[model samples]
Target: MKLNQFLRTALVACAAVFTIGVSLSTQAPTVSASSATYKTVATTSIKKAPYHKKSSAGAIYNASHTKKVANLKTYPYTTWYATAKVTLKHGSSKALYYKVKNASGSVSGIVWNKYVTPGKSPFGLKYAKSAVALDVNTNNNVWTKNPNTARPIASLSKLMTLYLVRQKIAQGKGTWSSKVNTSNAGLKRLGKSNVFGGFKFNHNSYTVRQLYLAGLIESSNNAAIALGQWVAGGSTPAYNKKFIGMMNNQASEWHLKHSSFVSASGMEQNSLQPYGYSIGASKNANYVSASDIAQISRHFIVDYNDILTDASVKSMKVDGQTLHNYNNLLPGRKYYQKSLKVDGLKTGYTDPAGYCFVGTGRKSGHDRIVTVVLHDENEFTETRSLMNYVYNQNLA
Candidate 1:
C-alpha cells in the first residue's frame, strides 16, 4: 500500500483505541476483498525434543536442534491499526489537517508540537520616564519615554567640534599634521574654573589632529580652544561664527531642528546668568537634543569613518601618553558582552548636563542600534541599564 494510505489506516485504528479504548474486536481492516488475492497456505510447525543432551564436542545441544521432524500447525497473530485525523482551525476556515498514530500501539512514544513565547528586553529599564534609542542602520526609532525633549548635551557637543574639524579638513582649509601653537590667551581661556585643568600652559604645541583627538576622545577644552582659534584665524568672533554655522549646517543635514550650538565646548560658564564661558565665549553654553546627538553619531559612523580611522585619531600619542578613544564600550568589559559589536563613540558630563552618552552597536544581520541618554543623574548605572535594554529589545 501507498505510504499515505498506510498512515491513514494506522491513524484510524489508533483513533478508535484513543476514543473508545483498545479492544480485541477492533481488527485491522483489509484493503482487498478477494480471498484469492490474499491467500493463506498450510504450514507445519516443528516441536522441540526434551532437554539434557550434550554434543560430542562438549557443547550443550538445545531441544529444537535435536528434535525429530513432526507435523505442526501455523496461525497468523491478530494485529490492529488506527489512524487519527486532526484539523487546525483558523477563524471560520480549516487551516491545516494531518494524521498521526502510535507505531507500537502503546501511544507512549508519540511526538507532539511544543509552543514557546518570544522574549522581551532583559535590562528592565522599561520604567524609565525619559529615554531615546535609534537604530542607525535601519533608522528605526525605539524610545521607551520622552525622546524629543530638549536637554543639555554637555561635552557631547565636542562631537560637533570634531565634525567641524573634519569639515575643514575636507574643504582643504586644515590638515591633520598642521601644528597649532597654544598661546597664553588660549591657555587662560581653557584653564578657567569651568574648563579643563589640563590646559594650564601656553607652550603646549600640538598638531590639528592631536587637538581634535583630545577634544573628541578626552573632552579636552584646551584642544577645543586651540582648534576653535585656528578655525577663527586666532579671533574668538571668527571661530564662534564658523562654529555656529557648522552646527546649523549639521543640524539641518540631520533633520534636527530642536538643537543649537553656541560654543566648541558644551560647558555653561554659570547657570545663574545668561552669559557663560565656552572655548572662546564668555556667555551661555550650547544646547542640543538627544535626537540630534544620535544623528551626529550616525553621521560619524557612516560619513566620517575616516576621521576615526586616521592614524592620528587612532594612535595619537602626546606628552609621553597615548590617547585612546573615550568610548568605554570599545573594549568589552566583564559586565558587557563583546558580542554586541560596539565600537567607538563619545561620552559627556557636566554639572548642568549631568552625565550623557551616545552609544552604537550592531546586532543580528541587519539591526544596528544607537542609544543616547541625557541629563542622567547616575550616568554609569543608567548608561549600562539603557544599553542593556536596547541590546536586548532590538538586538537580542
Candidate 2:
C-alpha cells in the first residue's frame, strides 16, 4: 500500500511539472522597441478575445476598450514602441495588451500583445521627405510616411494634363493626330533657352501624339505648355487662366483635396513669366501630397492603361529627336528588376520639389503596386525599397 501511494504521488508531481512547462512555452517574451538588444520571441496565433465594444480582432483601442482608435492596416510593417501593459476582461477571463506608439508619437493605442514583436521597422524606408506604397489590385493604402503633407510636384502636373487630354479625345473634341501649333513667340523663347527640352518645331507644329509622348516620357516643359494651349484653345493669357482653372476643377472633381495647381507645366510663375505665360503666385509651385499623387497614379493606370505603352518606352523618335524616359526603373535601366515588371508612371523635379517619382510595378500573376517617393534626390532607390517592402507585407 505504501509503495503504491508513493508511485501515485510521483506521477502527480511529474504531470504538474509537464503542465507548467507547456504553459511557459506558450507565453512569448515581451520586447519593447527601445530595448538596446531587441530580441524576438515567437508568438503563436491568438484566439478571438472579447471586448466591451463591438470590436473586431487586431484593433487598437482606448484604455477602456470602448472605442477603436486605429486599424493596424494604416501602419503596415511598423515597429511600435511598447510602453505599458494592461489586463482587460474577456468574458469570464482576462487578456493582456500592450500600449504601443510610433517613433514620432503620432500613433498611440493599446493592441493585443500577439500583434507586435520587438524588432526594427520592416520597411526600413529613408532618404525622402515623404513616401508611400499602395496596392493597385487590392486598392489597399498599404503603407505611408508623411503621406498627407503637401510638397511641390514639379513636372508631375503633366499627369493631370494627360488625364484631361484623354477625356477630350473620348468626348470627340480632339484626336491624337490633331495638330497643335508651337509657333508662338513664347515657344520660340523656350526653344532658345534649350534647357527645357522644347521641341525643335521644324514646321512649328506637332501632332497631339508627339507632344504627349515628349511630355510623358521626357518631362519636356515646352510640350506640356503646348498641350495645355491646345486644350484651352490658344496660348493667350485668357487661355492660360482657363487651362489652370480646368486643372484645379478636375482636381476638385476627383476630391483630391490636398492638391493645388499653379501652372499646367508645373513651372514656377516666375519661370513661366519669362516664357509669356501667367498663372499662380510667383513663388508658389504646384503642391500636392504624396498620398494624393498616389491616388492620382492609381486612377491613371486603371483608366488609361494605354499610357503605359508610351510610359514604358525608354526612347521615342519624335520629329528626328530622341526622347528618353526619365524613369530609371524601366527595363534595361539602372534600377530595373525582372521580377518587378515596373512599367509606367511619372518622374518630376525642380529646385523646390527635389526628385519625385510615382512608380508602378507588378509581379507576374500578382496585384500591381503603386509607389511614391517625394522630395528626395534618391527617389528611384527609395521607391524600390517601398515597393519591395509592401509586396512582402500582409496589408490586412
Q: Which one is best on lDDT?
A: 2
What tens digits encode model 2's per-residue C-alpha lDDT throughout 1-396? 000000011110001111123222223222234322312233233333222211122556666555567665444545566656665443223345666665444557676665555565555455789888888887777888999998998888889887887778888999999998888877667755755644565667889998888889877777787888789888565676788789889889889888988888877777778777766564478888888888888888888889877799988888888877878889898777686789978988878888888889886655888888888867776776676555544341
Model 2's number of clashes is: 0
lDDT of each: 0.50, 0.70
Q: Lowest lDDT 10-mer window, candidate 1? A: 1-10
TM per prediction: 0.59, 0.69
lDDT of 1 at 138: 68
For model 1, the superposed segments whose C-alpha errors exceed 4 Å read 1-129, 184-195, 199-204, 233-238, 271-283, 307-316, 321-326, 332-335, 364-366, 394-396
Query: What's the distance in Å from true for residue 195, model 1?
Result: 6.1
Overall local distance difference test of candidate 2: 0.70
lDDT of 1 by residue, 9-122 (tens): 111111111112322122211222321121112122223111111111111111211211211000001011212222222122221111211122221111111110112112
Which RMSD values do the candidates have, in order?
22.6, 16.1
